[model samples]
Target: MSDVRTPTALPTTTIGPADEPATVGAIGYGAMSIAGTYGAIADADVTAVLDASIEAGANLIDTANVYGDGRSEQLLGRYLAGRRDDVVLASKVGIVNGGGIGKRGIRGDRAYIHEQIDLSLGRLGTDHLDLYYQHRVDPNIPIEETVGALAELVTAGKIRRIGLSEATGDELRRAHAVHPIAAIQSEWSIVSRDIETYVVPTAAELGVTVVAFSPLSRGLFTDSFGPEDVHLGGTRANFPRFQPEHLGANLELAAHFRSLAHRLGTTSEALAIAWVHDRAEQLGARVVSIPGTRSVAHLHANFEALQLELSDETRAEIDGYAARVSGPRASDPNWVSGGREGLI
Candidate 1:
């Protein structure tokens, strides 16, 4: 493990139980990349990133069972051995990855959810998850049945709060009716604003915190990203936005966004996160951003965005970039919540 370089603590935010809420760091750590979602990561680097996140007060660690086929959770389990209580642990179920192109599916049936929770708990080495999400909505299973299973976990003390990832406004509403949803995790960044059309408004009305994942557009808003980065490995290479035809146009737009960040005396990645925080406030919704990184320096940099304040004008300018992007948010719209908007 590497030593922590910066130890600045992030500000706090509240996530709901409706009956009682829990306070957690405003900026959380998303463990996807550490498990090779972006590319292969060394065990040492993963340890350092996890260590740095907790040291800097970004203790809200989020992961999913499908991430590296549960390798991410196992690594976190090792790290949380003696100090699990010090962190706000969250993980998700659903979305089985078959390890090839177009070989995945979502399952939210009671039996599957029940089986996965135990596996998640065993791998995480924790008896309970602070927040558990339905990684993706299962088209075959009704949202009500899925949420009902999660509600049972809450009763069993396996999960403290319920969350739905990439769920549409209607899906969120239906799930919330079955049981109070503490948060809705989705991709909400400079380029992905479709959620603002309906999901954000619904979450705001229900008083559910919007946990913004990929707030930096999965590195598109960062300095290191480029058209050639697609070959570096992981699933991002297959995303439509990074494909040959759309990459150039998106890169040009990112250049302008990066220039704006440079003028503001901040990294494009940090500025992108600040934009999410600012926009959430403007939309009358509470948000916590979980930006994943394999580097400790990047971890510290991500949490530093908590102190950033963006002006109304600047936020709108950043918001404008969303319109010019060239591809759909996902290769298959059906894979994300926006695609399943009207369906159950």
Candidate 2:
């Protein structure tokens, strides 16, 4: 029984050079929940959540080919069957799972490329995808080869725009050279601010908008975690970032964020998102936050974060917290994504 807030009038927000309208209502639907990231959810329940997200002013929906072994796209497609045109649907490919072979990696071969798109389309029940991304780099494939193939898809009217995820600045530049990238989706939460080094700058230079995922530090910055909280669950249990031994130090850093967020009269989630939103804008770039959630209530909470602004002091406090965080912010050692990239 998830609570869904009704869509209220969204404040006028500007979009960046290659991005969509900055504010498309509040909150966006994250299809990963439907794929059972933390726990299993009935397909009907996922549909209800999707529709609930729409009712809550969520027009942007995020999903991937790997999510639920492609179930998210299928379910989302089935869920949005009649109203596909009403939403901005985003799906990603790459990360080829070679029939459970350790050969699992990315594939951009023209034949494979076309095949994956067809599969995603069939699953999503859409003629074209609004945004399509390469989920990960195929150490076996060249960026030029991959982006070139994707560019052809755009010309064929199969996709509206192109984006890259978990990519380095060099990787992004290479992709953008082949085609004008619309967005660059990545994990850019307060804890995963590694992108501030080059991804943000490259996006600004290339007229690409940054779509930030995990804007809440994978729930660490929410009201739940504290200096004393340490039990980790899900696959994160194996991650060094969430290891019980390191929990105390990480919690201490999160406290700094909590204090600053409180002073600003906003949730840490709100403060974190606002920092990215405002900073990107100040740099003459547009940014969007797409925090994923299982409950529509959480979605609404994430969306409302955009309404809260951080003053200079609050922003500075957040930077201070970032500096104090212990260990890598992302689920570390599980995978290497082009080095300091992705939702760390």
Candidate 3:
């Protein structure tokens, strides 16, 4: 294991659990990467990464039940045993795996919600989760019914706060009316800015924090991968942005941003994370970025974003570069949710 560097002072943001608030670092650790979604990660390496994250002051660790068919939560459960109190543990439900591997189905019915929470708790080795989210809105079940079930969990002390992922503006409002939402997790990055137009404003108005996942744009914003590196097995392979046809254009856009990062004396990954954080600050909405990685070095590089400050002019340049990106954020139509017409 490598030595963990001293992390810079991270800004604080308060997320709501109705009247209650939980203050956590603005940057968090996304656990999906370690679930072997991209590639296999050693158990020891996963433990080391979690240790380094805690050492670097990233106390919010986010994972989902559907990730690796509950493998992610199980891994966190084993690693977080002694240090559980030191972190804000969050896990999501609603998306259930289909009969075939990689096939998935969403379920937000009252019974499914009741059963999944207990299963998540058991797999996580915790009596209560600091924050719980509905991974995807189920089109069959009403949002009110799902939120009502989540509110029951709070009353039962199964989860401290409630969150919704890929929820639309109207769905968010309706859910909030049933129970206050603590956070809204979505794919928001320099390359993917679809959520900013409406989701950000709705969350800001409802006093809900926006938790930005894939802040690195599925590693497209990083220097490690390029157009030639797109493979057929991993998560990125299925993303439209990473398809061979569109990847070259995306890489061209990324190259421009990479040059800007070089001139700014920072890594492109760090700059990408900083851009998301800075944009949220400018919008006057609380945003926490959970950038996931399997490598300790990459994790450290991401944390460096906390120390890099982007000027207004540089931010504009990055924004302009992002506008040039080609292809949809994800290849699967189901992956693109949270819009008015798409909300479940």
Candidate 4:
């Protein structure tokens, strides 16, 4: 589908469990938090985390071309430089040319996408990327044009698989028509359930996996946020929910989730991850979760989430916390994502 140059061999790794656990991972790493935000991470640190993830049994790594203006991929490339056969190396294009603060634009025109594949391959130091996604849908460009171009990548062997991020159901169908979307990367945590109404079902019918990002509610579900936790060195600082006034209210809601977890004999983080997996499955969707973290211990904790299963009554309890509230996801509409009318 895309003529973007690809690596010679495909990585033989999968992110989900063999049985499709109620939650996606047995263990997955979030390289973003450790290295810093979507910006700079030293090659040494990236090398270390890559080692840690494999030791922890994580087979996948998620990153974007705009991360550290491609520094994240560079680090990952260096880490995976020689071990290419061992992991599922996933990266994206479209969200490019961001400022130092991680503010960037999404461009998915065919020509731009072709050039981006080359750039991502160069930064990632791979010929054939296992999975490639449109980091953000460009509103100015049609979804078909963007996905059609991606489909060509699949045909050309540049990208073994294709996915879309921040797309609506209609957009997904338009894209899938041109190519089979292996996944749709969107914020599908317990808090961000908008995809439930349409996107999830649409993806299910197409047999495309829902690659849920931010499954931890940006660490709010960990029962770790405090008044002092505000303004940490990442996008959470600018998020509306992390604002001083909303922090307490949001944490209160998070505490309710935590309380339910306690009654169920699990941590709130595990409960949150389980709920996302179950929610999509109830609707017949296949989910692949990537909750980014710098710590392997936390990665193990997240892996434990796979063992969690709530009955209908308990599912309702968890759903109650999310259904009743509308919290701040972004500080401004501009950075919220997908930048399309009525999509967010």
Candidate 5:
């Protein structure tokens, strides 16, 4: 039987582009999980998650154009028909997923940027996105040119705010100079701390909110699934950290963390997310964590994390254990573009 807990009210946080400010629940929903990335997810299940999120007071709904070929946004659009005003809608572009196999590419050109935003708006069934992000940094184009095009969209009201996903500190600075970068999306968790060295500091210094995706480290931190559950047909099977050789070591570390959580009388998943909240507080930076899950029960569990408060001593212990985690966050170095990786 699945372990289910009582739902708790989640607190709200503010994250917006440059001068614009918008408030959303502390824990946002990452819609990609229901787009069949890991496996087939029924539309009913997707709706349930969305409905549960709204009921739980989670108003930040994030999706991307590449997710299931834009099906993710369409699902949200359908669920958000009358309730659009209740949530902060966010989506991304720049990663082109159409054309023949292998035709996929990242584009930041002015024409491509202009074209994608309209298509995304159509899919999302919204006139203007609360926040729009570049799914990946297009190395071929200059950051200034990309941001310039994005700025045009902001002026035209196609998107209220601009965000960058997987952007390096230098790239973020350049993009911000072109136009105020409202937020930067990157993969950050106890097991994945690569962004802390530079991206976190830079975003903090610039007063840009860091939207930390995959705050549960793609489910490893939750202890709900083990290495044996990762099969060839699954999305996580392609991840290096979930591979046979690395899985054992990673699970061992997770087990240790889970034990610590048990001692604190909370679930591992809650503790893992609370660690992220704690880290953001320590940095004095605005951060929003979007942990994806297709199950309503899991969604409830995730929100419960917002109610947890970790002591300095416990935080240090978790950090020390995380330092010993095995394997790279991403198996493919090419996927680690713009200094962000482990994104789902």
Candidate 6:
């Protein structure tokens, strides 16, 4: 039997500009999985998870326009029809389907950002998003121009605050100069710490919140995960860490991490969350981790991490394990900030 606990409110953290900071739950709900990123989930299950998350005070809902090509936002639109005020709604622009079949790329031009914001608003059924993000930085476009467009949205009442996903230290600095960046979304789990070297310190210096995505390394740290799970299909199939060549070695590292969690009397998922939280404190950065799930039990279980504190020895061991994990964070490192910044 699963150890299910009663849902409780997540502690709050402030995001956005200093004068107009918006308070949101520290543990936000990532809506990527429901977009069939993992697999096809029933509409009813999706509704259940969203309802449960918001009810538990995990009201900072994060989604992207490219997620299922707006299917995810449409689902959230229906769910938010009557409950719009309850969530600190967030969505992204920039990353979209490219010219060719199955091709994907970034689009951060002024006209494109303007067009995408309205489309996202229509899909979300909201006049304005509490927080908006550039899903990925466009190498062809200047970060200043992208942020300038977002700043116009803030002035036009289309978005209250702006954020950037997978942005480098330099990009964040450049973007913030044009407009105060509220948050930065990046992959920051025990297994993916590439952002810590430069992006984190820059964000801390600028007072931008670190919104950690895939904090569990896309279920790699979970108890039920196995090599067979990735073979079943979805985005994980495209991830290098889950490929046959690296799967065994990564799983071995995961096993050792799981054993540590067991000794601490907690699930690996919970410990992973706690580690991100601990790392944030250690680095003097405000962080909010958005871990996605189709199961309400898993969501509640994730909140358990808020109460789990790691000792210095445990944190050091986890870092050691992270260092030994084989493979890059993704198949196309260029698609991520760490890669663009030459970290990977």
Best by TM-score: 6
TM-score of each: 0.94, 0.84, 0.93, 0.85, 0.91, 0.95
Candidate 2 residue runs with Cα over 4 Å from true position: 1-8, 11-27, 97-104, 225-233, 329-344
Model 3 weakest 10-residue run by lDDT: 1-10
| Window of ten residues with lowest summed lDDT in model 6 | 1-10
lDDT tens digits, residues 1-344, model 2?
Answer: 11123434543332223344334543466677677664667776776677777776677788988887898888888788889877788889887766432336666666777889999998889999888888776667887888888888989999878878777877889888877777787777666677777888888888777777777766678755653333322534444556777767877777777776776566777667667776777666556677666665665666666576556665555666666666675443223342544434
lDDT of 1 by residue, 226-261 (tens): 866777655776777888888899889989988987
Give the alpha carbon lDDT tens digit for every residue of 1-344 in model 6: 22233444578898899899988889999998889888788999999999899887788999999888899999999989988999999999987777421268789999999999999999999899999999889989999999999999999999999999999999999999999999999999998999999999999999999999999998999887888789553678678888889999989988988898888888899999989988999999999999999899899878888877678777777887667989999667878888988889
Superposed by TM-score, candidate 1 places the C-alpha of residue 215 at a distance from the truth, in angstroms, of: 0.8
Ranking by lDDT: 6, 1, 3, 5, 4, 2
Candidate 1 stretches with Cα past 4 Å from truth are 1-9, 342-344
Give the TM-score (vs. native) of candidate 3: 0.93
Q: If both were scored by lDDT, which would come out higher, candidate 4 or candidate 6? A: 6
Candidate 4: C-alpha RMSD to true structure equals 7.9
Candidate 5 lDDT tens digits, 71-120: 89888888888788999999998887756223567899999889989998
lDDT of 4 at 100: 42
Sliding window of 10 residues with minimal summed lDDT for model 5: 335-344
* Best-first order by TM-score: 6, 1, 3, 5, 4, 2
lDDT of candidates 1 onward, in order? 0.86, 0.69, 0.83, 0.70, 0.82, 0.89
As for candidate 1, its clashing pairs are none
Candidate 4 achieves a global lDDT of 0.70
TM-score, prediction 5: 0.91
Residue-level lDDT tens digits of model 4 in 144-256: 89988987887888987787887887888888887677778887777777777778888888777788888987888884555564555556766667767677788788778
Residue-pair clashes, model 5: 1
Question: Residue-wise lDDT of candidate 3 within 184-272, one digit each (tens)?
Answer: 99998887777777788899888899999999888888877776556623667777788788888988888887887887778889889
